[model samples]
Target: MTEPAPELVRGELTRELARAAVAARTGVLRVTGEPGGDLHVVHGLVVTVDSPGAPGVRALLARPGRTSTGVADLRVVAMMAAVDGCFAMASGWIGGCHWQDAPEAAGRPEEAMPPVPGVEPGWLLLETERRLGALAHGRVSPHRNHLLLTERGRAMLSGPGSGSRREILLWANGRRSCRDISMLLCRSLYAVTVEVVRMLDDDLLAIAPVTPDPPIPEPVRGIGRSLLPRRRRGASGINDTLPPRPPQPARGQRTLTPRRTERTT
Candidate 1:
């Protein structure tokens, strides 16, 4: 039997994921490109993801080689790690991806690849759009040192289940810039920058001025007010009716009027 070569199609990670989601395929997405990674999906739900430069469950867990316990803890850690890994993997150009039957486990430690916290395909798509939006605005310099929280942002934080959005709000603090926030959060600078930019686009965040501006002097304000003259309050001052005209003389003769005013006792 003649063996067939693996099909290689070049596109974006989001595109491939969209196709898989629409078809409701249960398979492993093997990606190789600028930032390579593997994502496992069952019936269009993302189960796990592995990517370089992103911390997985093993790296996140406190006990790497200790007693195996706490299935619930493992599940939570796995979920966070998987989402982070997927974010890292989906970023940048995607060379190609190969889809195949879903595997029992990925090529990582069982603890790190727990089968919990499956993400909806639609959610993944939304996340990808957010990251791309952030990237478009990531041109912001690393030295930026100011951010202001909007009313909408405050409202969002006040609510529950904002997830990374809440974390970003907490770190923003109106005093730290994107770079500073990233350092404080101990996450990727690019990741933090993306969030910052997206918030800015959505009007949820604003760049704070480095130095507080001086208040306008009271004298200056008064001067400004004085520049404008007050408007007249009464009706039209000019008389609409004209006084009676002096009697006209002949064409060749001249006419004179008395200058003194008439006095009455």
Candidate 2:
């Protein structure tokens, strides 16, 4: 047979597969009981591999640490890993190619089974990190499939609790964008944005300008000046073109004093 593709032979794709699978188990990262450790949010999904598809995917995960494992036999090892509580679940792609996790798979009969979260750690995930440390180096994936998290990954989502003011403060740190902060905090796009704004008003977060504020509109300034009536010209000579107003009117009362002749608008 002709030489296998570089990715296939060198296990580049398998490496990606393992990395992703590891992420599915570890990406959401829930380390409960630790200081500053809480499940903030998760992007990982539960996966179900079809007979052939899942077998291939599973095999990739189990390839290493096997003495007599071949490509076909890799799935068997993966099953063992899951059976032994290594993998959270063996995924099944329902449709449209989305690998839905088991927990998220509820209520949706169509579309791929959603990716599921895993709190417990797994050997494959550990191996993946050791072997594919490069993959986890950057920010978590923005795309659906690319962001898969393992059991440990799901735990990373534990942050400030639901509707907690602290959660908003976490997202609004340094005026981080909702999208970026959401990724960091493992929350959804909408949750971060609304919560961040709420915290901002509370002074728990700062309103940061992405760019310099645009120059103040001259007309607006002029309108502000015209809000007061033009002072009648008088000997008071305060460049008056506006009415002279008395200081501190009674509550809910308005006092319109005659404009000094010197006053100009």
Candidate 3:
């Protein structure tokens, strides 16, 4: 019989475990997820983040010669790598993976790993969130799902803009969506979309719909009003404001005629 599938771990729950490990100041935390990589944290500091898809800590941080190799340097690099890994994990670059708190899972590699300074687990989580936000603010758009450049958007590219603004303006052509622009320009869709939206807000791009307004509804007619039931007012379920009247006689029937008043002598 096939063994049961490993429980897929969510990024949020894994972060929580990291927080706990940081608080305890003793446990090791392992987080495995897609795009496909693993992160090992010991005593609230990250040791290694191995993901082939993304640049490792060494690539992110400039390496100094043998003279500069110190405990502080190692720790800083390790911490940076951890942050990078966290971003990747949170972004779901890696496929769904599992996590465990066992000592074996947290074991340091046989090779000398970069030394990481003691950092708070909560702090790391907070930093990751902040970076994610910054990443979003630069590329992602909250209001727009699609990107379509206007005539003005095209003109701005050759006009007076500088740097990234010029690049985005040049790339926008009313046909590509934000994701398309992202891939074309080697930038994040979130970042590209934000700029596009800014341009749109500035009237530099136009994407409003051109359909005509809906027709006004006709007024309610007497027939519509007649369908409603008439309401009576009173605690006893009858209109009480008007005085009660004697019941009318049935059709073709007459009520007892009042006796002829006897002439009172």
TM-score of each: 0.42, 0.20, 0.39
TM-score winner: 1
Q: Considering summed lDDT, which 10 consecutive residues are worst modelled in model 2?
A: 86-95
Q: Rank the candidates by TM-score, best first.
A: 1, 3, 2
Query: What tens-digit string does per-residue lDDT give for candidate 1 at 1-265?
Result: 0111112212455677777788877788888864567888866778777776355566556432445468878776676666666555554445777876765655665544425767876676565545444464354443344777888888888887687777788866777766556545656545666677778878777777668789886754546756888767544544346665667798988667679988999
Provide C-alpha RMSD values for all models, in order.
19.9, 22.9, 17.9
Worst 10 residues of 3 by lDDT: 1-10
TM-score preference between candidates 1 and 3, better one: 1
**How big is the positional error of residue 148 in model 2, measured in Å on the Cα after superposition?**
29
lDDT of 1 at 210: 66
TM-score of 1: 0.42
For candidate 3, write residues 1-265 as lDDT tens digits. 0111112233554555566575654344444544456555555455566553344655545432323457676666667666655554554433444555535434656433334554555566666566555544333332233455567666666677566777666655555555455445544333555576677767666554435689999987777757887765565645556778879999999779878877877
Give the C-alpha lDDT of model 1: 0.63
Global lDDT of each candidate: 0.63, 0.34, 0.53
